[model samples]
Structures are given as structure tokens and as C-alpha cells.
Target chain A: MTDWQAFFIALLQGATELFPVSSLGHAVVVPALLHWAFRQADPSFVPFLTLLHLGTATALVILYWRDWLGIVKGFVRGAVRGRIEAENERLAMLLLAGTIPGGLIGFLLERPLKALFATPRVAALFLILNGAILLTAEALRRRSERRDLSREEQEQQFKSAQQITFKAAFVTGGAQALALLPGISRSGVTICGGLLAGLRHQEAARFSFLLATPIIAAAGLLEVPQLFSQRGPLALYAAAAVVAGLAAYISARFLIRYFRAGRLDPYGWYCAAFGLLALILLR
Target chain B: METRGNPALAGVVAALGALFVIISALYAFGAVSFATSDPGAAHHYKHALVALAIAVACLVAANVVRPKAA
Candidate 1:
């Protein structure tokens, strides 16, 4: 792999990974569409992918540093006392609850799903479905009392992410497990789950990002051993991780603003159009 | 809490992303090269670099053309 190729991959990884669009979908589609000589099943490639996820998770942490710090400190305190009263403690538990479903699904079915559905054709098809899912979620959210909020109303709407029930978070995480498929998005599904649980757009999005961080980081953590054992693109992989982290921070900033006043309609349209074009071209 | 939209931040990011594209393109066009004492290693390295340049070019175009989140 070349320096630029790594940069390119990391760029996509950063931009799409958390944007309610499927990074896995893009990973499958872009390389095939461009006819790169890259091989996904290669031993080195898996580690590279893990590092990309790590980069994104790092971006999430960097952007939400204070929130994470408070959560960590509160969780330690709560664990010691065997009680949870503060907002951070409640939120930390919610995030943990939200991680279980997707993590379990990924652990159980990742290899088979990748084997069966890694093709551009399958990914493109799922991308179309993912579009429909987003549109449906947006429509449902709009019909409710808890639609997208204004900057001022946002503060009044939910006191904290802790306002959401632990059961709701778990269900949302379970919904995220659908992302085991290449084009089924963890963020989109979880955000939709949040919407259904009566959170506004920004609230849902915040929960989605928080819910995603640990899963993304844990994925990379598990693969760290493989990275050490593998002999490929060490320096390039590191660069890709850095570039991906930079892009993800910027993308995350844009997305948080976008969700406040915007619907997921644009992403829905993009997924639909791009998926259709890929289907046509690949056909 | 990046609550409000900021055009300046968007522009800055776009410019930075564009820079990556240009630099990658230059590398692809052979504006950059590496030297090695071993002929075979050098040949392989050069080939890989050129291929990477091409790949990056495609990615940069795709990234630039894609819609922004906002």
C-alpha cells in the first residue's frame, strides 16, 4: 500500500464511521468501485481496519474529553459505593448497557457476515436499505413530541443522557448490532432506537456517539495483538490512524451541529443515490 | 458541544482536506521518490508508491465530492 492509499482509506474511515453512514459499506464499495489491488481478507488488512476504528474512537474521546472524564470518575465512585445518583454515573451505566448488544452480535456473527456479504453488490443493496431505514427513522422522529430541537430548547428537553432508561439504551445497542451487516449502520440504528425511545435528534445522536466509543475502541484493543504479530504497513497504518482521527474530529463537529437543526434526510438521499449507482455500475 | 454551525471551521477543514489531495497527487505524479541500495526492494517500493498515489487520487476525488454532514 502507498502513503496516499492509506490516507485515502483513513479519510473515508473518519468521515463515514460515525456519520450514520456505514464505514464498512464504504470500505466494501469504494475499493471495488475504484478497482484497487487491495485485499480485505489479507492478514495485514484486518489490523489496519482495527487501527482505523481506534482512530475514530480516539476522536470521540478527544472531542468529549470532559464528559468522559466525569463519567470515568463518577463510575469509580459509584462502583465503590454500590450506588448511582449523579448524572455521570447514570450515563456511564447507560453507555455500558448500550454496548452489550452490538458487542455480543459482533463477537458472535462478524466473521460469517463478512464472509457472506462483503461483496460490493451486497453492500450496495444494504446501503439502499440503510437509506430507507434512516428516512423512516426521521419520519417517525418528526411525528413525535420529541422532534429536532432548537439550540435553546435542547437544554430544556433532556437534563442529561442519564434521562434515558438503561433498558432503552440496551435495546438501542441491540439495534446497533444490525450493523454486523456491511451497510447496516451502528450509529443510524442506535440513533433511530433513541428516537423511538423519545429522544430528540441531538439527544439521540449524543447517545449514539457515546454508545459507539467503547465498541469501536474495544474492537481495536482486541486486534492489537494481531497488529504486533503482523508484518505490514506499520508506519502507513500509524499515519492512517492519525489522519483518520483528524478527519473524524472534524466530521464529528459537523455532525453534532447538523443533527441539531437538520434531519438525516440528506444522508438518506446520498445512501440511496450512491447505492443505486453502485448497483447499476456493478451490474 | 459544537451546537451551532460555523462556516469558518468548515472552510478550514475543506482546505486542509484539499491539501492532502494535492500532496497525494504530486506523489502519484512522481514528484516524490525514494532511494534504496537494494535494487529489487527499490523496484517494489517504487511500484507500491505509484500504486498508492493512484489510489489516493481516487479517494481524494471521492472525499471532496461527497456531501458534507451539515
Candidate 2:
């Protein structure tokens, strides 16, 4: 890939990966829509993307280092004491439960999914579906809010990730697994799942980001050797990764604050419009 | 307050952990293959890490579920 292409792809990876938009979809479809020549099927592509994912994961880890530290301590403490009594321990276990479905599904079916639907056209179509999914989730959440629960009743709902049940986490993980599809967004679906599970937008976004770290890191960790292998331009790739990491860190910071009072409506509309535009242009 | 814990379930989870670690070893040794694309030594090592992580998680989970009072 050309240096500019690599840089642009890295920027796209960083920002969209955190945004409710599908980064993979953009990575796949944008090139085709713009008539960029690099083939997604090129042997070096997956490893390059994996490296970018690693960069984004690193950004997330840095952003949530305090939470991760607490989670690790709690996990160890829970294991030794044979009880998940603390909030940190519970959050750790919740993340474990939340990671399982996506990890397993990605491990087992990622290749097949890519083989079947990796085409830019298909990704574009799924992007529209992703938009619909996001809008529907917001509508449902609004409907639920209209129920007019008393202050005490609203206070009883899950306010933080730690307060959620394991079952909720498992189902949210299932939502994450849906991102295996080319155009689906991991953060989008997980935030929707969290919303359904009673978390407000900010907390849902926070939990979604946390749940994403391990999966992204694992994908990168598994392929680190390939990233350093002799076939690609290692120096250029490293530069792109740094770009991606910085973009992701900034995006995560922005999204955290935005979701505190913002809704998914704008992103949903953008996905729908972009998907439709890509569909027409690519055709 | 004392809470109920299932030791038997913990044992089962621990067994699963052992099985995954064994599978990880097999991958590391190149004793197994998946039906998809051709993989190199790095691929095998990568999968081995995945299995090892899973095994570790399971082992920890087993401990978390084991009866503390027993």
C-alpha cells in the first residue's frame, strides 16, 4: 500500500472503530468506492489490519488503565477467595462473560464470514442494516423511558456495568458477536445491548469500550509475529499504527464525553446515508 | 453472610481449563489443523496463546466458583 493510503486507512481504523460506524466496513468499502487499487484479498491486508487493531486496543488500555488495574486485582482476589464480592471483581467477571461469545464466534466463523461477505458491495448493504439496528435500539430505549417509573424505581435500575447481571453481559456479548458481519459495528451493537439492559448512554458507551479492548488486543496479539514478518514495510506500518492509535485515543475521549448527553441518532443517520451513497457509487 | 457455592461445577470448569491447555500445547506442537487457510508456525503459536488465555480464564473461574466454606 502507498504511504498515504496506509495513513488514511489507519486514520479510518482509529476513528470509526470507536465510533458507532463500522470500521471494517469503511476499510473495505471506502477503497472500492474511491477506486483505490489495494485488494482487500491481498495476503498482507489482514495482518496489517490486525496491527491497526492492536494500536486501537493500546489506546483503549491507556484510557482505562485505572479500571483495568482494579479489574485485575479484583479478579485475582476473587479467584483466591472463591467469591466475587467486590465491584471490581464483579466487573471483571462480567467482562469475561461478555468476551466469550464474540471471541468464540470470531475464532470459529471469522474466515467464513469474510469469505462470504467481504466484498465491498455486501459490506455496503450491511452498513445500511447496521444503521437500522442503531435507530431501532434508540427508539426502543425512548419507548422504555416513556414508562414514567418513579424516582425510586429508576434508581433501582443498573446504573453501572458492575451492577448488570451475568446473563445481561452474556446477551450483550452475543450482540457483540453480530459484529462478525462485515458492516456491523461492535460498539454500536454492544451499546444497544447495554441500553436494553438498562444502562444510560454514557455508561453503555464506557462498558462497550471496555468490552472491546480484550477482543481487539487478542486479535492483534495473535498476529504480532506476522506484523513483524519480512513481507511488509515494517517502518511504514509502524508509522500508520501510531497514527491509528492517536486517532483512536482522541475518538474514545470525545465519544465518552459526547455520549454523556448525546444520542446515537446522528451516527445512525450518517451510516444509513453513507451506506446508500456507497451502494450507488460502487454500482 | 454465607453464600452457596458449587464445588462440583468448579471441578468441571477446571477440567475444561485443563483440556484447553492441552489443546494449546497441541497447537504449539503443530499437532492440529483447522479446515481453513494454510497457517504458519506463527499461526499455530497465536492459536496456542488464545487457548492458553481461555484456559487461564477457566481456571480462574473455577476458583471463583469453588466452595469457600467447604
The sequence of per-residue lDDT tens digits that candidate 2 reaches over residues B5-70 is 678978987897898899888878887755336654444777677778878877887777677764
Compose the digit string of candidate 1's lDDT tens values, residues A1-283.
Answer: 7788889999998989888889889888988898898866556687788888899999999999998998888656554543455778767657755664565466446767777898899999999999999999877766654447664474356434668876698799888778978887788888888877877677888888988887788777657766887788788898899889999899888888887767788988889888999999888
Residue A31 lDDT (model 1): 86
Model 1 C-alpha RMSD vs. true structure (Å) is 17.6
Off by over 4 Å in 1: A146-160, B1-70
> Model 1 residue A158 lDDT?
42
**Model 2: per-residue Cα lDDT at residue A222:** 73
* TM-score of chain A, every prediction, order shown: 0.93, 0.94
How well does candidate 1 score on lDDT at residue A227? 85
Pairs clashing in candidate 2? none
